[model samples]
Target: MIRIGAVSYLNTKPLICGLRERLSGIGKLSLNLPSRLAQDLAAGRLDVALIPSVEYFRATGYSIVSNAVIGCRGPVWSVRLLSRVPIQQIKRLALDEGSRTSAAMVRVLLSEMHGLSPETIPLAIDQTPETVDADAILVIGDRAMHPEHGVYEEIWDLGDRWCRWTELPFVFAMWVARPGVDTTGLAEILQASRDEGLRSLETIASREAATHGLTNEDLHRYFVENLHFHLGPGERAGLQAFQEKATALGLVDTPKSTL
Candidate 1:
């Protein structure tokens, strides 16, 4: 079996819908957090994995595979900043340790978009986002979509922020495989699965609505409006742009990005 690392999150459900059955003969999938998945891929525990795009730059000998991706044209509801004050006034930023890419993106935005460089603290799984000392909190994944976010004075949608700044979409994750891994025919399966999942989004909404305490309509809209899956030409350009910005900030030491 070809070991594959998959991120366990709602946004990813669409990309992997019916994926196991399709790749049952060639793929053995293991689901984990984005950070762990990246680690597994780097250690050769996985042949391929869907990883935070920033991580693809950390190591060599990998190639991005498939047009399938987790991205947004604008306002991805799940990756956002909840702040008690305007971004410019932020003095301390708490970062959710769940995903490094989102954290780095927020840092880039904080410096380039808002022109503020605050002390950033890593928030543990049990830490509250509304800590007294935190002026802004970068929360990602399903937690960012929670109803409690309404209490924040400012809600900065990072995807929309990226689009506003760059006039391009933002790609959060991509599938990468170790060098020489056979990707032939896999891209078709990956993209096709996303198409199939999107076509049946209502069903997914119905099934997962309660998991996040969202109404079916709310969940359905999230699947339809807040997410974009295809990694087309535009997304590639956005990906390159992101790499350039990330590289510029010294977040990446490689001096160049290949994928």
Candidate 2:
């Protein structure tokens, strides 16, 4: 059976909705953090995964497997950088432990936009942003959807910043398979799952809102307005742009080829 892993973030609901049942006879579905899923896929523990975009750049033999994606055209409320000081004045940053892509994105944004190379620390997944003492902190996934208690000098929705700066949509994650894997009909299954998920957003929001401490309306709006689920020409361009920037910044090695 194919061992497929998916990200466990709320944002991924639309992509994986009804996926388990659909894959019942053909594969096994599992949920994991983006970083862990990347590790598992690279180590041959998983045949396929929906992993962070940066991880895709770092892999040598992975192929993008589906058009369904986790992306943003403008402000993505879930990937945010909260600063305690001015952007240029940031000297130290703390990154969420669960993020591999956002960490690289934050570094690229800082270097490109402000020309500052700040020291970075890790903010454990269980730790709140307030627990970290740094000039700025990067937060991702469900935690980022909620506002922190205190004030900051600047709050950047990384997707919005990236789009405004590059004029392309930002793709956060996508389905990928290890080299030599048989993907003949996998793409269509994933795409169909995405379509079904889109139609069930209200049910998904209602079921998940309480778990994430968000109102159903707010969660539903977030899914509809702040996120994009398709990988098209614009998203592809943005992905390539991000890959180049991350490569130049030395966050990831040169990619073997485009997916």
Candidate 3:
């Protein structure tokens, strides 16, 4: 059986909805944080993974499986930077320890869009923005959706920033596999799973909402409106722009898309 890695975030639920009953006979599912999934896939423990786009640049032999992605065209509720200081006046940022792509995207946005490169420190999982020794802090995943995070006077949603800057959706992650692996029919499998998941979103949202401390309605809206799955023409243009910016900023080595 092919071992595939998927992240356990609320944003990913739609892609994996009804996946077990459907792909169970084909691929083995392994759920973990996005960063860990990236590492395991890179280390050869996984046959394929839904991995951060930046990780594709760091590792070799990763051929992207097209037609699906974790991305946003507008304001993504998660992956935010919170601060009382303005983006220009900020001197330091506490980066999320769990983020690989969002953290890099923050740097890219700051350097390319704002002309600011503040000192950065890793923000611990349990640490609050006020407790961290930085003017601003990047928080991603479910924790970023917390009610308490509203205390921040300035909130910078990275996806919205990217769209406004580049006028294209920002692709956070995509399905990729080792080049030598036999991935025939794999993209079709991934796309089919995504289609099934999208069709059964309400049930998936209801089942997963409470687990993430969000209401069913909230999760449903997040799935249908905030998060985007298709890596079509717009998303591909965005990904290309993002890669160019990341490479130009020296955040990662240049990566060529397989599809």
Best candidate according to TM-score: 2
Q: In terms of TM-score, how similar is model 2 to the real structure?
A: 0.97
Candidate 1, 161-188: lDDT as tens digits = 9988999988999999988788788778
Stretches > 4 Å off in candidate 2: none
Q: TM-score rank, highest first?
A: 2, 1, 3
TM-score for each predicted model, relative to the true structure: 0.94, 0.97, 0.93
Cα lDDT for residue 219, candidate 2: 92
Candidate-wise lDDT, in order? 0.85, 0.92, 0.84
Please list all clashing residue pairs in model 3, or write none if there are none: none
Give the root-mean-square deviation of each candidate in angstroms: 1.7, 1.0, 1.7
Better of 2 and 3 by lDDT: 2
* Model 2 pairs in collision: none
Instruction: Residues 3-96, candidate 2: write the lDDT tens digits.
Output: 9999999999999999999898899999999989999999999999999999999988789999999999999999999999989999999999
Pairwise lDDT winner, candidates 1 and 3: 1
lDDT of 2: 0.92
